[model samples]
Target chain A: MKAKAFAARLALALVAAGNAASVACAADFDWKKFQGKTVTFLANNNPVAQALLAHKADFEKLTGITLKVDGYQEQQMRQRLVTVMNARSDEVDVFMSLPSREGPQFAAAGWYADLTPMTKGAVAGDYDYAGLSQALLKAGTFDGKLTSMPMNIEGPILYYRTDILKKCGVEPPATIKDIEPAAKKLKACDANITPFVSRGLKPAIAYTFSNMLHNIGGNYIANGKSNLCSAKGKEALATYSGLLRDYGPPGVVNYSFQQISALYRSGRAAMSFESSNELRTVMDGGERLKDTALVPFPAGDAGQVPTAIGWGMAVSAHSKQPEAAWYFVQWATSPEIQKRMALQGIAPPRSAVANDPAYRKWIEEEPVRKQWQAALDVLAAKGSSEVGYPIVANPESREFIGQAVQDLILKQKTVDQACADADKGLDALIAQK
Target chain B: MSEAAATFTEDRQRLELAALSAPAVIFTVAMIAFPVVYTVWLGLHSFSSTGKQSFVGLANYSRLLADTEFWHGLWVTIALYVLSLVLQLVFGVWLALVLFHAKRLPGIVRSLFISPFMMPPVVAGMMWLVILDPSLGAANYILQSLGLPPSEWLASPVWVIPTVALIDTWQWTPYVALIVLGGLQSLPPSVYEAAQIDGASAFKTFQRITLPLLLPTIVTATILRSVDLLRFFDIIYITTQGGPGNASNTLNIYGFRVGFEFFNIGYASALMLTLTAIVFGAVLAFNRLRGAVAW
Candidate 1:
């Protein structure tokens, strides 16, 4: 009889403990009020979709709100959002934006609702929202107003083959100067292998080159003036051109990110500068590239800096249910949920989740994650904004810069001449406004 | 009384005729005329796709005059149109001639030859891109197997334009061939028979008889192909996207980039109007040429 009584008391105590934990996990706000409301969420291609899908049932059960998630390619999403925003339509309730380009433009246009009012008081204090990295949060801010929330923190990194480097008796390059010698040594070691490879074709080639340009203290445009004719800019262009002409694959002039990744993964190229997002693709189920390693983006004469580009979620100005949207945003970006996302190999934007013990265990086991963290560290120090020029508001800027790069690299035009020609054209375009 | 009744019936008949044609005329005006008028109006102003508009009056046109990219695109369009048209016509007429003389298994063979025209332009471009891909494309693989130097068909700036032209030719030549074949089959068989009876050799008969009789059909095919090829977009967009430094960008691609991609609607409108005028002029010139030939 005494033992039975003790057992019952222990059972009740355990049940109470479980109830208390569940209560703590539940959001402080009244989720029932949002019942019957439908929310549309838009995102660029990110793995967060899977996590949202996984927890969607729980959210619906708690709030009785239906969530519809839509994903688009980065550029397409940007164009769509711009069209809708410019038209002042409520077609999208929430949208994914990149800090460097879309955030500033959208914020300037007042397309994003100011979230400072929504994120204050009891709700803000209930959540551990303070753990977001200060630098990343600052990037998302525009003129002292918080417009968007960061989803994943990402920057460029050097992807290399460990086996190949070992065979060549060389280490991965730590700086821009080291790259050439390492490439030469690797080339000498293996004639069949491309020493270094990068995307040097039209349009997207400029994106890869921009990272290097930023590291070398080169600016595309500065102080409301075109600065492509600067000495640093010229040297950056020459270095990029020389790398492609001398060390890159034979037909790399027409390559893009996909082609560069393919070359590196296929063991045809020794190393490349690529994004962390491509890590999953490179390391998945391929014997040839399973041993790939990631490192910080090489340092330039100015310093080691990688240009950070990432997509973040922002509530549209047209949303009818700002409160409900906030609830979903809070849920999605919460430390608990972000930790879950990290376990599933998705890069969470929250600093707390990124440094969590559970998340670190998984990251340590994966070579790609180690590289990603290394790249992130370098980015934290020397990373610059992806925004080059406000004149790039027009999409033709991408094409114009891309053509200039092609002219300098493939057509052998002097950097000054090429940039001057491009500047002249872009000036005309901007002047038309 | 009889004269009044006759006049009333005649007036009623004229009214009926007018009423019968009203819907067709109204439909054309609404669908076609309104947009053309709107494009012209929009062309006169500096309109943005973002709903920002200002009256720029002839400034867009002036810009077009100084625009090097526009001029480059215009020349590329001309080169593509002329090259593709000439090659397609030559190959098309040759194929028509061969098919006209064919007998057994000719129908099957002709269907197979013209099958490329049945595929959509996007699909056709994708097929060609794969076949011509520098790295793993079947074309390069076969070249390697045959111990020949591999050519960077799409990568080389010098060859990129010609390569795109070749793709256009490959896909469209069959369309011209089919049209020309229809025309050839419709020709009176007795003309050739008469030439044969007159002791004319095959080549002489072809040059003297078939050539003269096929002039109208050839002219029609030329006009049709030229107009369509001038507006070429899909193949170029899919294959090279006008790249390796804008080597294949025609006026259509340029307008699309400006109007849609860059949101410069006013400039794009002006560019479109210029393209339309060029097309219209070419058609008029070709019609005049055909009239002289017929006379």
Candidate 2:
């Protein structure tokens, strides 16, 4: 009889505790409100998706909602999303997107759900939306619609071998104009190592070339017509080609990110201009880590235009449960989750997490990581998210520009001639009604 | 039986014959005719990546007509076709003759020679990708070790097409060899015996006897190889993606890019159909010329 009475008292105490916890949770946020619901995320097998997948179970436990992630290669994921969005199907609740490339196109087609209202909802307090990078906010926002939430801001970054610069008695280039001299000096120091390398493949070439074009004050279009024939375009092409032709390794024309990264990592290349997203691949751990230095894309003569583009998360406009989907987006991008991912070297989109004492502590743990963090802080502050033409023909337009670059590289056409040809072709493409 | 009943029985037999053939006829029309018909219909429209397809008759065609890249793609396709075919045939005949004459371990050596042909085209291309890598590849490493300057095979525009052709030849020459080997074996041994009786030189006998009898088989091989080569895609797509600046872009690769990469369904449809017409016209012309050959 005494044991039974004690058990009853214990049950009563547990009930009281449960009620207090529920009241507190309801007051701040009720994560269990969407219990038993499921959300599907269509993602690419990129570093961002891999990071999310690594710690997804914690999110599920916190929110009490099941998550289904469908990961694919970059191209295949886009193909699958296009099919779903075109069908107006709600099968995919959330998807990974490249906002700088497809944001305007997707929004104009009514494929992206407006996320501004979702951000203003009841869970807004937990999100800390203002802490996200202002550059990312502008990139993901098109025509006043928040088409997506920034996941990562990746773009061209200059990685140099500090030892090589020291050996050459040269300073790291502070501007695009300084590259030719620095590279020449590095080559003179060591005839063995390639002094510079960048992507030369057709479509991939257009990516870095766009940064050079903009830094030289050349724009993609002028007065609603192709403007690559401008004098700035010629100079940009000459500079890009000249760097590769003069100091780049033989067969650099076939180089893409894979080859360039491998060359740099294996100590065959002294300097490389590649996406910052590749930090983990080349700099994760190596004997050469101590000699590596990271910097914002060397400032261009036109100004400090660093090419930055990013992957983002978006809700399909045709989603059946848009509010519930927003819950997943909000939870994934929460400050706490961003902090966890940031610890693993993912460039956080939130200013608070990036500037946190904890993040600084993490950086100070290693000399190489400190340089990486410093470089990222500068890039997050100043890089332009415009990496390509903003027209509907973004991809098609790139092929033409890439061809012009290749033609110049191969000496098939003079810079003026190639750019002229490309301009005419792009004009025809733009005028295709 | 009476004559009328016999005639009715014959009519029943004919009906049974028609019923037996119906499934194959239906399958052919459904499998082949539907896609062709649907593609032609789509080719007449204006479709963007959004799938908002609308009828815009002849515009995609006229646009392609004025497009310089499309013509360049066609020329590249033809060039790769003729070049790969010629190299494969030349090496194939020579290899087959050697394989046919080998009396010791012929079977084992022939199997080893045919191994490359067993690999899928995509797999073959991937293998060559590693081998031809400029910085960290075995091909360049070997050249450098031999005191020879390593040539930039796929990096130089001048060398890209020829290098890809060489890689394709390495994989596909055996396909030609196997086909020609069968033809070589089928030739009467008596022909060689009779030539030997006359004391003709081995070179003369092969020149006069072997080549004449192999024309029909060689022509058949050329036509088949030609069709495949004109629409070549996988190797180039994997290796250079017709790059170093459109150095090796072909008709099918361009068509696939338009369809999948750019998502311009209507234009891609038109491009593929035009390629089909070209292939068909070329095959017919070749077959007509084939009729006049004495084989």
Candidate 3:
């Protein structure tokens, strides 16, 4: 009996030691565990991807993985992704996606591999998963599945010419209501310059206009129907259109980010509201570098409810190497790489990266960039991703919203009439769901 | 040869013809006939982006008939078509006459005249988008310098259709001129000699002889231009994306959005089918006109 008890104790001690060793192994997570694995990344050739790709050599060196990147323009990238995903081809292992735009749609289509397990099991030692924004992560999650990881946080922010505003003898706008007055003053001061600009194209208007719509306390949908006919909705529609109609550039209605950036960069516009992703474009020639200031769009009834969205890194559900893909995603969105991306003007999704000293020093180098970082901070704290109607038809819903605003800008209809028309169309789309 | 030998030779010839044409026949069945038949099949069903499909019969068609956007797209398509077609035809003939009279024009000058048409439509759209920008464009700058009011070329909803039509006319007028020039060259000089003997004025001769003789060529041009103009997509898509209140939303643009953006495949197929019917009917009518005017 004594011999048997001693043998049992020895077995228990061996098992405990094995458990301890495994725990230590997990603590020192292996970055090179997936060495020699290949990951194909479908990347949109946007600034964020450009920034990440610049440091791709570092990732390859650190992880020993062959990263094959297929980059295309944004719309073309989405089209390619859709075709590849629909065919259930394992051609793409990792891809960039805008979760706010296509998260639910892709999730419903079963195109996104659920990353919940990989995120918990395969993260690095200093991954600090909790450092990522909860709100953004929630945006990327659908039906309890973590579909993607946020790459860069962005939204429309007001980029104003300090010299123009000062020359026009106008104070900086403090509320959404003040923007029209400031625009008028700027136009009166100089008829040659375009006073203001924002997105007016049908598909792109939602990203900018949603800031106004949300700030004015309007909801895209309420009571299971489109609520564009609500009082605040009409108010937002009229105000946004009225600004462009009265003091905007002559073809303001055709302006999207590309035009808006061009106009602002040329020092011909007093104010421009465009995506934060456009910082590099707007600052390209360094002409407006000294005189420009960035701000979260001004307050309104809802008190500065900015629209914030981020492109995410998602492993394809059809990926033959999903776990390997997750390694790429985790490493790309890791604190160290994101810190590097943040210095290069990609707003990091992790709070820790934002607080990194190198990133802080980089922002401090330029006054405009400092203000940009400050505005992004505000966005991170209080932004919402409800750019359009939250439905499977969200992208289609934006068209109706843009149409209503465009109608008002053209004076084709009264605010009430425009809102009613939009609601009619949106209601049909809503019913489709 | 005997009768049996002759019959065998005929059979061999028939077999040779089939073997020679087999690739083209297979190509047509695979490429053209398959997609068209699939599109028709898609139109009769409700299809979702997630591979969910069900038979919905005429429901999509009925929805389209009631949809205001469809009617608006149709109206916009017709307006653009008529405006562009009229402008191209008038300018095409006038330029053709000018080129016909300039018998000693240099090859380089003729190439320059046709350069705009040679540019791809998307490139033309982008080039014009910059040149016609309301604020920073050279067009408005020139207008300002000349003490003329600058016009919102592509931005004004009231004028977007005309502006897009003008852009199309600018690009395709050269192509039309080339076609009309071909017709002018093919005309027999005997008619002109006879008119000269009759002491007919240039204007009078052109009205009575040239125009009447040119009607068939013009109708041919119209049929070709009309089919394209009715399904106009690229320039409008690149420049405005049928925006400024759906002012330039042609049937093709609307159909593309429905199919690709909304991924409402069933409804989009129905919309495209209707557009196809309209284009087909228009071509049929133009062909009838051409037959009536043929010499």
Candidate 4:
């Protein structure tokens, strides 16, 4: 009789706590506050955009706002945005961005609308603003103004063939050093297959190479100058180029994500270090769905400091309807929409969405999907956003890094010469700022 | 007619001519003069992204003069231009001669011959990118079957220029052939008849008579092609993107990356102005040559 009374008292306390949480949320907030409004979005036509656009009708129904999308490919989208932003035109209300690549540049140009004030005032009752990834939010903030909101988190990871590694008597790599021996064994076992693959295109090399550089404990700048000639930096360059030169497929100097993903999906490559966003593309044919496994790239001297970056949705500073634009940004990045997009292979930037039971159920459906999520979790926790130099000339800085790696891969220069030339070139850009 | 009436008609004719040609004049100024002048003006100033503009006054030019990458790009552009230009001219004439002698090519066959140049440049570039892939491409497969060594095509820095030259040649030689064929058909037939009467051999007739007369037509083709070849961007960009350690970085590609990708508008404008001068000078020199060979 005493135990039953205690259980009933505990249930009553849980109900009381729930009531307190509900009172904290503003139940009087209005969804149709901006009804009959229209906002234009400059989309990049990437996976995240496609997934959200699939539910465009639902957004209109919920908020009674018209969304006009102007979509283009990634590079063309940037060109269009620059044209509109430079003219101070109000044609594009909201657009997509990569904060790691263009955060400082856009902020310096005064192109982004500050979203911090709006986040506090015009929000839904259950918005849960604090549930977002604080690190990503910090990445989007510049000069005390929140410029954008993270839509998806992504970075490079290793996708290996379980059956091939087992047949060759090789184990999954636990560190950067283990990859070389594993590649050698796999090559000796089968000469027909390429042992390893990654991006080697000049403009594309930096995306994958930056992760290795940070893992090996190197920085793009030190002492207010370029530091590519440092000991750790040269070592990182040599190791990355050597692996591609010796074991990667022929003509890897021309390979980017398109070629890398195609090679691995065709059952030709034993190991692939490419973007985590390629999970859907790699699993399209359903052939490797059973044998492929994903993992965070092996740790280096500094441990697993993987390069993590996310696409963001930002309002244009010149938008005539800035409030309406913010509504679209908030709706697209909400936990519910993010949960829907998560199932479409766009990893969520919200902690609540990541732990939602529906997302967990979707992940458990496939073993590879489960491993992909675990790898993304590690990326979210320990990843750094330093893809290249942290300066206004970040995009230009990537070209120098790519040139150094490409020089090594093509055997046009020794590691010392390549790094020295890169440092000389990068120092000029650094000084220009 | 009275003097006053004639004078009035002359004035009216002058007004009509001016009114008729005004639109073309305006178009020419808008399309050509405005951009060139604007580019020069921009080249002289430094502009920041935050709407900051200041007169740097030849500083960007001085920097361009010392830039080794700019010099390298000029060299690559010239090398690619000369190679593809020569190939297109030679192969184009040969194909025209063959077509002239055969005289019985079906309409379908003739149309197929002209199809390559009709495709857009971007489409051509994308098509060749797949066909030239080192491993999965049919190009290497065919070489292996013929007991020949497989080539890396666009991947090797050593062979990149020639490979890209070959792609351009494949796409444009037919257009060149059509131009040469028009010249061939317009040839007076009287000369060939005279040579036949004299029992002159075919080889000698071609060397002594036909070759000299074709010079004017070939020079016209050269002037038309030099303008395009110097600005060759689409194929190289889609295929290599000035890769493998800047092996194929032409002036056009480098300037584009600077202006669009880097947003270094001042330096990019300077580079573009220099390229424009080179192209303009080259076309002028070719015009002089064409006049000299105008027989």
Candidate 5:
């Protein structure tokens, strides 16, 4: 009987030790904890996504989680994300976002997960939370809600043809006051070429036009009323539309970023105003890249302020596996990955990547890249976050602003009439609870 | 046969027929009736994209009535329906006459002519996107070479609807032609024979006899085509996305944007139901017109 009792006690002790070891293992950080689980990431077909997809195996190996990415064009991707989220589905655990445009609407609708806890808690030590730009982080935040993590900061900048500008004996403008005169000189240099090209499509034009509006010291909304008819507002509208209307290409009325990029690349436009992120596309060839130069939007009476926006990776509130999703987000937005993406033409949201040795060296050696980076640096530091009205009905609100711009360009309505009509519409939209 | 035995056999046959068709009946109800009932039910309630719903008692309908875009979209829908119908019918009948009278054409040639009708509408739109590209399109190149001014076909706000209408006509006219061709081929030979005997010219005979007899077929074809035209979304969407600033916003595109893009489910439902009513009302009016016209 004594021998049997001793044997039982020894067995019990051994089992307890084994259980304690297992508990210790669980407490330690283990990437493989979510092994064999699957995550679906909905991505837009952008430079960041392309780089992420190219290196997806690294993530899967680190986490042992199967990753499936459904990539779509930007517009289609947003529409799909809205549909999936509005259905309150957990099918998609992680997705890409342009927080500047949709942050308020999405956060208000409770479509995005509040990431503050994760940012400060367990994932804090693994992820360098301070590495990202505070401005970009604030852009991703809405009404005290931290909904997304910033990835890239992009805004419209001037891309001018050096050969054309030089032949015309005109120097680059340091302010908006100089653009009109320079445009005339360039137009005189070559009648066959358009002097300027920019997005004229409604809603889309509002994006680039906001930069112009900012330059002249105008605001879209103030104190819950439309401020588009302010003296500076009229100046911004008339200036932007007048540039395109007077010296633009024949079909400039319908031009957006795609057409504007094509025009500049085709050597049809001497100067193009487009997104800073379009370096890869605008710099299509080595020779063209050499001739091309990027400059900050010229300063106006107020100052040189451009409108900038940020794209981010976000977890859905209804995610079935929030931890696994965050692991993927953190791993993707880490310093090393961001540096890699920046070298490949995506504007980095993290200061670490911007200060990385290799990225800085590449910018120093590459002439076209040097100019583009200079423009990005200025805009990143000074750009305004309110590209359009930040409202739940943001898409609807843009139409009012765009219509005014469109009417100005098409010569269909007077500036006063356009603003008044748009004001009525905007006032009504603002009245919505 | 005895009366009792005969009655029993008839009843057994009836039961067997019902048994054979039961699957089809069930399928029709599942596919068609259920969705329609659900759509109507949804139209009566205010709903969010996340499936949140509240009864609002015709508020959505009243809102649409007050909305200017709704009325504008309806006007645009009617304009497209009428314009495309006219172009398709005219070109369709003309092409049918040519194909019907010309027997020497090779089978390959006829097949090539019918190819556009076989192409998907979205595919056709994309193909035209290349052909109508303002900078590098063959259409503009040819025009410039011919010493003519190049037109901004799809880009121009004033020309988008008409250009889209023309593209639609190019695609669907063949379908209308095939239908009218069948009607022409099936016509009684005696009428033409009588006209020839009376020394009537070919044009006169076609107008007096062939057209009079073919009116019913043409009317039927127009009604069918008009129904399709009122719901036109794919080509316009694939081409312009109702752009250059709401210039080409059609009823179908408007409703889709409201429902899917804007995520206002109740308003979208009301828009679609109104569109459906428009389609049904148009068919009823056209049928009445057909009845009034004597063949």
Candidate 6:
């Protein structure tokens, strides 16, 4: 009888806590005051936009503000954001940007308003805002100032054919050494299959190459200089080049991410390194790849792990309504909205939401979900920030490096010669700057 | 007093001539002169895409001099120009000769031959890209069925320039052929018939009469193709984007990359000015050649 009474008191306390949190969340904002204001959002044309549109009406009902979203291709969106920010035009209130390329530049230039003050004290605690995955939050911050809020968390994972592995009587490789043997075995089993594939062309291939280079403990620039000639960096390049030359399909040098994904999906490739975002496309649209398995990128000798590029939302510095923009940003990135997005296969940046019972259930329902979650965990644990190469961010660097890589792969120039030539070009660029 | 009146009448006549050419002068000044002057001015300064600029004297030009990529791109441009021009002329003349003798289904044949010219360059590029795809493309498929090794046509460094040339030729050869055909049709039949009566063979008549008369038309086509191919960007941009490894990059694509992608507008403008001078010199040389041909 005493145990039952204690349980009753515990249940009453939990109810009171939930009620108090809800009331606090409800009291923080006056939605009716901003009824007539229109909040424009610049979004990329991806799955996230459709998920946002589904929740659009709910946001409007809650805040009494009209939500207008404009979707553009990733590059087009980047160009438009830069144009608007540089011109200080009020074309967009909230903009979506990836952390690797545009985020640092935009933040350093004071193109995004500081959100540190808006998120403060008990109000912050009531929402699950504090649970944002650390790496994403860190990426969004510059010099200890919050410049942006993450919309989704993504990282690279190894995608493989479960049926192919079974047919070959081999397990999925967990380390780099195991990959070659497994590839050979799989190839022996099927003469038509390419063991692996990646983007080999310039600019398009640079992103994957950079990630792998970092995974093997290489840096684009070291101590304020180009490090392409470093021992580890050269080794990384050699490994990447050898993989494509030896294991890839005939036209692998010309393949981009889309082609790589298509090869894997069409059952032409045994395995590939691809982003988690491509999971839906491969599984849902690709009937042949429906039974595919996702795994963390095979570990290198140095135990290096690669991270996926993630997107974040930053309030424009020129926003006419800073307070209102912050309000919407806070609402959108809140635990409630993030959980909703997670249902649509978007990995929420908040670990709490990602670890929620409902989210776990959703993952359990899909064969590839566990692998993506596992990869995320691995990346979270081992992935380090990419070393800042002052010149790498320049568009010219992309062209120079892209050409050099292509030349090396096509055997037009030795790797050493190509790197040396590229270094000179980069040095000239740096000098001009 | 009568001589003075005559001098005034001459002055009035000169004024009337100036009035007649004023529109042309104004149009050239507005469209061409202003842009060239502005580009030169921009070339001498440090300008970025975000409207950030400062006067830098000849710094942009000096930078261009040191840019190896620019030089490489120039070579690619010239190689593409020469290759495409030669192929277009050879194939174009061959087609024109064949069509000149066509006595049946001439209209339908001409339309079929001219169809490629009607498609936009970008669309044509995309179509060729699909056709040349190494794995799924029909070209490789046929080659493989013939018991041949698959070739990376677009992806190979050595093959990219020639591949792009092929695409350009496929689209523009018909245009040149049509122009040459028009030239062939307008030629008097009497010249050829007179040669035939004198026991001169078809080849000899073509070599003597047709060749001599077609010199002006050939020069006109060469001039047009040279200018058009010098600034070649669209097909290359759409097809390989100056890859694999800058093998297909032309002067215009290089300038675009420098200006927009690098955000170094001043240096790009300098490159443009240099290209303009080169193109102008080529046109002048072509004009001299045309004059020689006329003589």
Where does candidate 5 stray beyond 4 Å?
A1-27, A122-126, A361-365, B1-24, B47-53, B130-141, B193-199, B287-295
DockQ of 4: 0.53
Model 2 alpha-carbon drift over 4 Å, by segment: A1-41, A56-71, A80-93, A121-125, A318-332, A355-362, A429-433, B1-28, B48-51, B106-109, B285-295
| TM-score of predicted chain A against the true chain A, for each candidate | 0.86, 0.90, 0.93, 0.93, 0.91, 0.87
Give per-residue lDDT, candidate 1, residue A390: 47
lDDT of 2 by residue, B18-41 (tens): 899999999988999999998899
TM-score per candidate, chains pooled: 0.85, 0.87, 0.92, 0.93, 0.89, 0.82
Expressed as tens digits, the lDDT of each residue in B100-215 for candidate 6 is 78767568777898799899997998888778878667889899999998878887778888888888898889888888888899888998889989999878888999988887
| Tens-digit per-residue lDDT, A1-433, candidate 2 | 9999999999999999976764554366767677789999998998888877788898789878899898898867877887787678999999988887767667767888999977765363457788888788888887899989887667777889998888889899988999999999888889889999998888887778888888888888889998888888888888998888788888777788878888889888888999887888887457567889988777776876778777889999988988778888888888887887788778788878877888878878778777777777777876776665777667778888888877877889988899899888899777753
**How would you encode candidate 4's per-residue C-alpha lDDT over B1-295 as one tens digit per residue?**
9999999999999999999999999998899889888889989988664445689999999999999999999999999999999999999899889888878998798888878999998899888878888877779889999999988888999989999999999999998889988888988899999999999999999898888889888888888889999989999999998876788999999998887787777788999989988999999999999899888
Recovered share of real interface contacts in candidate 3:
0.74
What is the C-alpha local distance difference test score of candidate 2? 0.83
lDDT scores in order: 0.76, 0.83, 0.89, 0.89, 0.82, 0.76
TM-score of chain A of 2: 0.90
TM match of model 6 to true structure: 0.82
DockQ of each: 0.36, 0.56, 0.65, 0.53, 0.33, 0.32
Q: Cα lDDT for residue A304, model 2?
A: 67
Best of the candidates, TM-score: 4
lDDT of 3: 0.89
- Native contact recovery (fnat) for each candidate is 0.37, 0.56, 0.74, 0.60, 0.28, 0.40
Candidate 6 residue runs with Cα over 4 Å from true position: A1-72, A76-94, A108-110, A113-128, A187-189, A318-345, A352-362, A380-404, A412-433, B1-38, B47-52, B97-103, B106-112, B196-200, B287-295
Which digits, one per residue and each the tens of the lDDT, describe model 1 over residues A1-433?
Answer: 9999999999999999865654554445576778998888776655556555677788788779898877776655666776687668776787777766646546756778877766553253345666765667788888788877766666667888888999999888888888889988988999888888777777676567778887787877765566667888777777777777777876566777666776677667788877666666566566544567777677788786677655567888888777788777776777777788667756776667878899889888866677677677667656666544545354566676777778876755878888888777766655543
- State the iRMSD of every prediction, in order shown: 3.1, 2.0, 1.6, 1.7, 3.0, 3.2
Q: Model 1, B41-155: lDDT tens per residue?
A: 8788885534567899999999999998899999999998988888999999998888777756566777898888889998998788768767656888898899999888887
**Per-residue lDDT over A49-168 for candidate 6, one digit per residue giving the tens place of the 0 to 100 score:** 667667888888987888888788675676677668767888789888766655555665578788787665224344655687778778778778888888877766778888888888
lDDT of each residue in B96-177, candidate 5, tens digit only: 8989998998989888777898999989988887687676567888999999998878777788788889999999999999
Looking at model 3, residue A234 earns an lDDT score of 83
